[model samples]
Target: MKRRLALTAIALAVGAAASLSACSPGTASGTELVVTTFGGEWQKNFTDAVVKPFEKENNVTVKQVTLYSSDALAQLQAQKSSPQMDVVFFSGGQETVAAKDGLLAPIDPAALTNAPDLISQATAGLAGGRGPVVQITPMGLLYRTDKVSEPTSWNDPFNPDYRQHVAFTDLSNSYGTLGMLMINQARGGTIDNVTPGIDAIGQSTRAGDAIITKTSSDLQQAFAARDIWMAPYSQDYAETLRKAGQPVGFAIPKEGTTGSFITANLVAGRSNTELATKFIDYALSAGAQEKFVTGMAYSPVNTKAVVPADMQSKILAGPTLEKLVRFDPEQITGNAAAWQKQWQEQITR
Candidate 1:
């Protein structure tokens, strides 16, 4: 399709330009490190918990290039030969793309003092030993208290009563894509054959029941305007919204939830490998992981990171953690692009 082709062209153009600006890794000084990060509240939490502390301890000046994970990956691809970034943070499975492209170096676990504190899956989900998972937040439904009835079945997203008021993140978002997989499997379709899910989306979209928005801030505004009542939402966002006095509550669809694991990766051949590695190690330390989870409501990857008794039911851990719908990262990578294309062609039509 022209859209896909145009996107590819733009990327190629960006890559061509970035190669000129990207420098060789070993050429940099030890005092400066660059990282790609998201903006707004998430960035604030990270700055408080990870960035500020790392800078204080290591005496390094971290220059952040603000970017979403997807944008960061594209920048990496563009600048891989002479990457501007020293460390990258992205969702777990997504790092595999950078790994396959040879943009990420394998992390030395011995360099990480906090490595032993992580849960097995978090440590293992590292794009095949290329990095480490820093934190995780499970994805599920969140709804306004006054707008609609409780959602017991996952099928309710398509129900007529919810029509025109349901908000959804676009499929490009990890939560949105994984949400489709959960719905598909729950609707008796396999990951490889998600026709039922696609059909349901088409039906909802055509009926004008699906209101697609791009970010948490957008969702917050939509909820305030009462244009959206329910969404495939994250626990962290839900908690933040509730604390800010938005009448939001977690909705447990009978089908359960999926985890979105965040990973930290070192750029391949970066000049600041030592400092970059230390930053990652510091992030995984008990102190950092604790702040990351409790401050933002994301579940910590560190086994030793404490979740207070009051917060247990809201976070993924113990019994809730045990019940998560874990998918193969390889499965997602193999299928996601095709799925996104199909979703655009069919569901968004």
Candidate 2:
């Protein structure tokens, strides 16, 4: 969920317009459930793996509104008085803030049949009264294998030879935020004091050694056109670039990496809490998890999901999964605003 104000406004407009369609009577004459999701390929993968199956089993029509996590949060706040959305997807710990703001409803583990199958990492949110973590995307260094040598460390982006060829994601993106935090931590800066990371990256940007990108699409375009040789991005997206025929390689730097735990939460005030919980449970099921793994290359949070050895190498699993550097979601949620402000003023500006 990386974005700036303008893109957010456009997303809100789209949400407002799409909300009208969400209220329409179902032609199938069944229950209707509205959910928030990413657009394009992501929406297609989710529909194939989760939405369509859930719809068939439950006899419900699930309407998906395409919005990044930030805009989705904004739309939830706007509709807080009466939430039109039943299920919402979040990747950047936005669920933490949304839950605290009462925009999300609590989950009952007993209501979710797949609760017992979830990995311990996915169950953390249940105790905090938020939704269970449905999927995970690890952050890592992405490089064009042909254009640059493999990056074994996060500091590789700062190498003088790669100047002007390094793409830095703005903090508005969730992965961007995590990448910056990882670099900041690797450089001896705490979450409360990210100046070291900011200053170091900023020095490169100021010297015209790096290009600041606003969205995942931007990264793809840059890599596709050879505008950038390397960047810090999520592993799932790295696969996207590879499948698109870009010569891409992803690495979990020696300093370690973090991950985006995409969560599916029941929106507060939705009349279809039971149905929404059912959908959430289906998303966490081994069946659906397997589909997501094959369709989207996302790491499954269900311990029972069977990923082949070859496919496992493509995702954040096994030894690579164990290398994840855990950060406090509560701290990240609390400091996100100030960090964003600092990012704009000190880095992007």
Q: Which one wins on TM-score?
A: 2
Give the clashing residue pairs of candidate 1, or none: 25-271, 164-209
* Candidate 1 residue lDDT tens string, 1-349: 9999999999999998776444445445679888878778888999999999888888889888788888888988998777778888887376888888888988867777887767776667453656787877888788888877667766878877887888777677777777777777778888779887877776787778887777777888878785688887787888988888888877667877677878889998777888888888888887887787678888877777787887777777634565677777778878877888888877556
User: Which stretches in model 2 have alpha-carbon errors above 4 Å?
Assistant: 1-30, 318-323
Model 1 TM-score (2 dp): 0.86
TM-score of 2: 0.87
C-alpha lDDT (0 to 100) for residue 22 of candidate 2:
59
Q: What lDDT score goes with residue 307 in model 2?
A: 91
TM-score of each: 0.86, 0.87
